[model samples]
Target: MSNSAYRWMVAVPAFVVVAAFGVYLGTTHGAPTALDRSVMDTVTGLRTPTLTSVIKDVTVIFSPVAVTIWTALLAAVLVWRDRSLVRALPVVATVAAAGIVGEAIKLAVSRPRPPAIDQLGAVEATYSYPSGHVMGTTALVAAAVSVCAASVGARVAAGCLAAATVVVCAATRLYLGAHWVTDVLAAICVGVGVALVVPVVLAAVIGRLAPHLPAWVGVPAANAGSKA
Candidate 1:
């Protein structure tokens, strides 16, 4: 299917389905379900000092600030190498969409973090229905992977790294007792939707807007960042 069709047919449906799941969680008193609690306990129970140290580093590595810094570096490199920012638009758009949508849902849900009984890691003391850490990292990986290059092999490598980052980051959050299993899951789902939808939407906007420009803007995309 074409990108636009894929977004409408697949991405939009994914977003709706995940959104419904979020609503379900929100209505459930924000309590960890039995399964969620079980998973949280298992992950935290296995933590060691070495593991704790590793988890702490992952915490920072995937933090929103770190993700933004890395994203900027990636965009800078692309613009410098290509002498165009078109390749970086999807990366920027996805990150922006993720932050805005994640925050909106978080505040609307206002679900509290995992209870004190299960808490072991440093306190976040923030809403946790959909993990900000998970969402941010997910968007970062999705955007980075999507924009890293135009070659299939390069994109595949990027996908592998993105997947690994998401897994490790998600596990770190759960292992640290910073989030319920459901919180991370929901964030992943939501992030996937945003990653898929944002670039297509942004591309369409840019495509339409490009024609009316005064020729002072950046050149038309080589691939139009077409991978998105």
Candidate 2:
């Protein structure tokens, strides 16, 4: 099979594995147990007062805004201006698709949040299996790393920053009692699955289309900075 076909094949299996694992976790551990609660609490407790306060206050801050602005800018620069859309589109599209998939999985799973903490205000709705925040952020970071991979030093820096951000975001969710550990893990799987599939698919499309685009449009966009 061709590379594009191979990517699609891999995506199908990876998505299935993530979805199945999410289902198992949701069904077997629908509710957070005492142990789950204790672990979350311990992690929350370990945060310094300043850090905890910042996390509590800014847990959801800038995520939606950052994703929106970055995606738009990247798409416009790569697609419309530089014709490198093939390089940039996958990252934006992957992050957006992952957000949608994460929400869908949460709806299907319908797991509840931890019952032991008052760190975060209660969420009235059901379906808390996979955290949208974690999944979405992971997708964004992965995309950032891919887009900046031309430079080895930049790639290394991006990777470190991305890893740190994911850790902090996941920890913040648990610290604020917004999601369970299993939920975060499921999000990670879903995010990874999406990250792996998007670029290869887009690269294949780009290979076919790049030859026809304007010369000026094929230039690579400058790396402004890491978004993670």
Candidate 3:
């Protein structure tokens, strides 16, 4: 299928799920659902000093500051590898968009974090719905997968690795009682959505405008000349 068609297929369902989940969380901000309580209970129950230490160590890697630093490095490497801003732009844009979208939704929803008594790890300062950690990491993983995977088999392998990373990221929040189940799940949806959709849209815009823009901006000189 065409890139446009594939993007549309992915974007529609992703945003829909994010919107629906956000609305649900917004409307029911008071208490955890049965499922939420059950999951939180199970996860928190498994918490121990060693386990918590390991999880916290892992979780810290996806913290906002860490994500920012690593994402910048990734973008730099991509630009260096491709020798073009065009390739790295999508990864940077997608990750940035994911962060902005995640924060916006959290403020709009204003969902509360899991109860303090339930928190077994580091308490968070932000609202809980649509976990930033999950969203950010998921976006990073998705961006990496999109750029690095070259073949169908490679894509599948990269996709599986990405999925595992996202799940682990989400689990950290749950294990810490920083967010409810819906928060991470919604984040995964939104993260993937933003990661996939932003690139496709950006690519199309860049494609159409590249020829007219300066070579340093996004269009390579030879590529621009070829188009001309």
Candidate 4:
């Protein structure tokens, strides 16, 4: 199948699952499932000061201020790599858009952040049906790997590293009782879906217009022209 088709396929199913998961969590916010409580017990049970501190740091990487700083840093890297703001928009957009979607889900669900009795870390003001930290990390890492990596091998390596980051971010949320297990799971799905869909859609649109558009509008051309 064509790459664009494959991306659309992944995007649609992934978003559907995320949506359904959100609805489930939203409708059931008042009631906790056996699995949910069990997992919470297990994660909360295993928490320690050292691990908690480490996970808190990991979770902070996706916090508003941290994400902003990280986005700026990533943009700088992309600019250094491709030297074109036009070419970097979709990559940056992937992360930003995922964050927006995650926030929207939180608003829509209005699920309370984990109760303090369950929390090892400070309870955030934001709702917690889907973990934005996981979403942002997933999108940020995927966006970076997709847009910044120079070769198949490099992309593969980046993907592995990004996946590890996502896992750590998600685990930290669970460890701190900041989110339910499925919240992190859905974030993973949404983040990955958005990351894949954004680049493919952007590339397809740009490739079609590459001939008619200004000389500075092509990603691959920009990529070829600049690398650091």
Count of clashes, each model: 0, 2, 0, 0
Measured by TM-score, the strongest candidate is 3
What tens digits encode model 2's per-residue C-alpha lDDT throughout 19-135? 786667666768675666777868766767777679866666425566667667766765653344445666677888887887787777778766644455555355677877788
The predicted structure with the larger lDDT, 3 or 4, is 3
Model 4 whole-model lDDT (C-alpha atoms): 0.76
Candidate 4, residues 1-228: lDDT per residue as tens digits?
Answer: 776677788889988988886778667763556777889988877888998888777777776567667888877776665556654677677888888888888788787766788987555667876788788888887877766677778878877998998888888788888887878888899898988787776666777877887665554321222244
C-alpha positional error of residue 75 in candidate 4 after TM-score superposition, expressed in Å: 1.3
* Residue-level lDDT for 60 in candidate 3: 89
The candidate with the higher lDDT, 2 or 4, is: 4
Q: Best candidate per lDDT, number?
A: 3
Which stretch of 10 consecutive residues in model 1 shows the poorest summed lDDT?
219-228
Overall lDDT per candidate, in order of appearance = 0.77, 0.69, 0.79, 0.76
Instruction: Show where candidate 4 strays beyond 4 Å.
Output: 204-214, 217-228
Candidate 3 structure, TM-score to reference: 0.90
